[model samples]
Target: MPDLEDLYREIILDHYRNPRNRGELDTPPAVRAEGFNPLCGDEVIIYVRLANGVVDDIKFGGQGCSISQASSSMMSAIVKGRTTDELHRLNRAFKSMMSIEPDPDDPAPVNGNGADIKLGDLEALKGVVKFPVRIKCATLSWHTLIQAVEEAQTTG
Candidate 1:
């Protein structure tokens, strides 16, 4: 069996090479947000459409390191058709998995027990916690996603 690291590397490369939910939404019925990592010049733009408090669709566009790009791609795939509440939970779980400190003011419940969070393919990014510099790379898209969601909530 391949080691966990090797498997994660393969998953990350696959997403980077063939990103899912890439590109932009054609019309204005969507919310968009961008995130940039000045240190690495990595940028990501997230486009989200919410319907009835659920993510109707999501896509991303930008250029960045393999980690950032892949994480965005994976995020897009996981978020589609999920409710805003679900996104909050998943976002908190993803951030925790990356060992990022939760914002005290944020209402998302992040109970540190990984076993309670069902990350699925997003788990491939857990390795990022070991590399402090790359953690930002992996999380840039997530921050952008949250912004997009907030934008959607406010507008509609």
Candidate 2:
């Protein structure tokens, strides 16, 4: 388990140092949202393009700590080409894993034994919950992503 945790750390660091999708999209994006953690000065901007109810493309630009930057990078990679529904599920799962309580009405599965409950590389972030202070660092981009996608659905 420790080895796996180390691997997860390595993955996070790699993404932070060499982020993926760390740029603005050339095409006009369907929606964009910015996230800021005033406590630590973490900021992120998310750009999303939806097509046929799918996340056709996504990108992010941000300046922050390793956790924040890596979270945004990993989020962009995971959400690309996923359906809006899938993105919502992912958002719920991620938040729950980070110890964020879910609303009673939120149908988002919380690590239930469902076929769709896979977290993939995003699982690397589950450990952030251990450090409550760092939880926001890891979640800043994810929350921004949800905001961007929901806003896009409303306007698109």
Candidate 3:
């Protein structure tokens, strides 16, 4: 039987190898944003299509380490069809998971919103907190998603 760490590693690697929603969306209907991590030279571009205050579709393009690419792929998979409110909750939860002071024993930490948002496959990224510098890599797509969402709101 694989240990929890091994399972998580496999999940991450799977997403990295076969990324989900890996492509682009037309900009007129989709808002695009890009995030870059200078320390590791990881770049992520997110294209989000919002309709009726919900994410109708999403896609990603980038080149980076496994962590960044997998994180982007996982995020793209989860965020599509989610409302902006749910996206915010997910962001808070994910960021909390990546926080430096997270309780080591707690597998699911509550976000500032006081909601224990289920991270689903995203839980695989919790181990990233152990490596401080890599947190940015894991979060690059999320930041880009935020920007895309903001632009989507304004231009949508």
Winning candidate number (lDDT): 1
**Please, what are the lDDT tens digits per residue for candidate 1 over residues 1-156?**
369889989999999999999999854698889999998999999999999999998989999999999999999999899988888888888888888776666656767644586877789988788789999999999899988888888888
Residue lDDT tens for model 2, 38-144? 98999999999999899998989979999999999988898899988788787777777788864455445545633357777778998888899999999999889
- How far in Å is the alpha carbon of 130 misplaced in model 2? 1.3
Better of 1 and 2 by TM-score: 1
lDDT measured at residue 94 in model 1 versus the true structure, 0 to 100: 88
Q: What is the overall TM-score of model 3 with all chains considered together?
A: 0.90
Pairs that collide in candidate 1 are none
lDDT of 2 at 97: 74
Residues forming the 10-long window of minimal summed lDDT in candidate 3: 100-109
lDDT ranking, best first: 1, 3, 2
lDDT per residue, candidate 3, 99-150, as tens digits?
A: 8443344333355633467888899998999899999999999888988898
lDDT of 1 at 147: 89
Give Cα distance to truth, residue 25, candidate 1, Å: 0.6
Q: Model 1: residues >4 Å from true position, as ranges?
A: none
Higher-ranked by lDDT: 1 or 2: 1
